[model samples]
Target: MAGAAATGGSARSDTYASARNWLLLPSWAVLCIFVLAPVAMMLVYSFLTKEFRGGVIWEFTLAAYDQFFFDRGLFGDEPARIDWTYILIFWRSIWQAGLATFLALLIGFPTAYFIATRPAQTRTVWVFLITIPYWVNLLIRTVSMKFLLRDQGPLNDFLLATGLIDDPVRIINTNAAVQIGLFYSYLPFMVLPIYASVERYNFALSEAAADLYASKWTTLRRIVIPSVRPGIIAGCILVFVPSLGAFLAPDLLGGAKNFMIGSLIEEQFKGNAGNWPFGAAASMILLTLVLVILMFLARQQARADREATS
Candidate 1:
């Protein structure tokens, strides 16, 4: 009887362990299938050849990567030349992304700080308002900006009625328009992260700094900013990387004048310039640049975290 009871208990324990393990299997399988598999495919495709036709060739080739770094000679010579266009597009994307990130930070940081310091009930309302636009599709929101910014759009019409200008200024298809689009698209990304960080901010530190005769600016710089640095960093990453690959906003708002790297890649893939290899190489290059930036940000974040913990 004693032996039978012990055996029954061991069986139950084994069954429970098996059930628990089985329950976790689906989640792990889904992650491997959806995320890890696609990344692996992209890595493999980056090295393959794009045939003259629409499909990719299985034959391994370094030519695509070679073109990414060094441009082929105009006559297709032995020594590959440098492609300045790639570099130019890269720099332009970075510049635009950097500007958008900076503006978003300037605006979002204070707004988030305000929301975080508010009472709990008010904070909920503020957060809801901040994120309301996100419920809409990104493309829809971007297109809606056009109706307001076009030559005879409401904004221009209002300005003309007020005698703000002699004629409607060409605001829609310029770098200024691009900046506006970028700021609009990336504002939420900036705000959310900053809000998360600022909510975790130590209220007592600010009070202590104030008691030490620190000015408002000094208190913010010394106490508040440092405490919420993670949020600011997170906001920058959220805004900057995506802004670099921004396509529709620049295409519709800024027109063809300010074509970013993303636009170029799209052209290569879909437009008359049907060079899939080139497009893939360009994409890989863009991914590499983003990874480098992400690494730097990660290192910085780690250092900041260490300092904070220490």
Candidate 2:
């Protein structure tokens, strides 16, 4: 009788496991269709020769990467020199994205703390209010920002009336504007992750730190930060990666003059430049750069985990 009961239980377990495996089919389908398929397309496109105008030829060549690394001059005949143009654009994108991440972290950490420290019932309302403005489309939000920061717009106009400066700040088509847009666009990504971390944090540990005579700053640096480091890292990654490829913010705010990697790639496919191979190459390069950074971070995290465990 006991053997019979065990056999029935094992059969039920196997049936449940089979059903669970079947349920994963849709998820795997979506991943292949949306993520893996597009990445594979980009990789293949990068090697193919660019057609006369916009498309790719079956012929494979390294000319796209060569163009990126070595400048063949305007007519494509001169001796190769290091192309600073694209290098500078890549550097600019990295710097701006890093700054945007920093700005989000700077503001996000405090905002998250404020919300997280609130009573459980009150926290929901705070989160809701914060997200209310973002309910509108991103395009509308960006355009609204442009209107507010334009030379004759409310921000500058208010400054002028109050005698804040001699001239309206040249912010409309500047890096500063790009930073602002990036921050506003992804602040919630930064905030929510940190809030999730902070919300789950053990406040008793904080109180214990206080009783042990640790200063607030010391407690934050030693206790709070280490505990929430994962969330902070997650938030920074979320903000930085998207800002790196942000076209709308740079295009609209920087007036297409301050070209980030995204704009540079966009121009190849959509703008006057019809070099599809070069665009694909640039994208693959960007993708590679992101992967390298993520790997480095993962290594660092692994090292930290080992140290903590040791």
Per lDDT, the best of the predicted structures is 2
Stretches > 4 Å off in candidate 1: 1-24
Put down candidate 2 lDDT per residue, 1-310, tens digits, no spaces.
9999999999999999999989999999999999999999999999999987799999989999998889988899999999988889999999999999999999999999899999999999989987887889988999999998899999998898899887997788998999999999999999998899899889898999999999999999998988777778888888999999988899889886789998999888985567999999999999999999888777766664565346
Give TM per candidate: 0.87, 0.91
Tens-place lDDT digits, model 1, residues 194-303:
99988987888988999999999999998888888888899999999999999878888889889888887787678454667667777878888899999999998988
State candidate 1's TM-score: 0.87
- List ranges where model 2 is wrong by over 4 Å: 1-21, 300-310
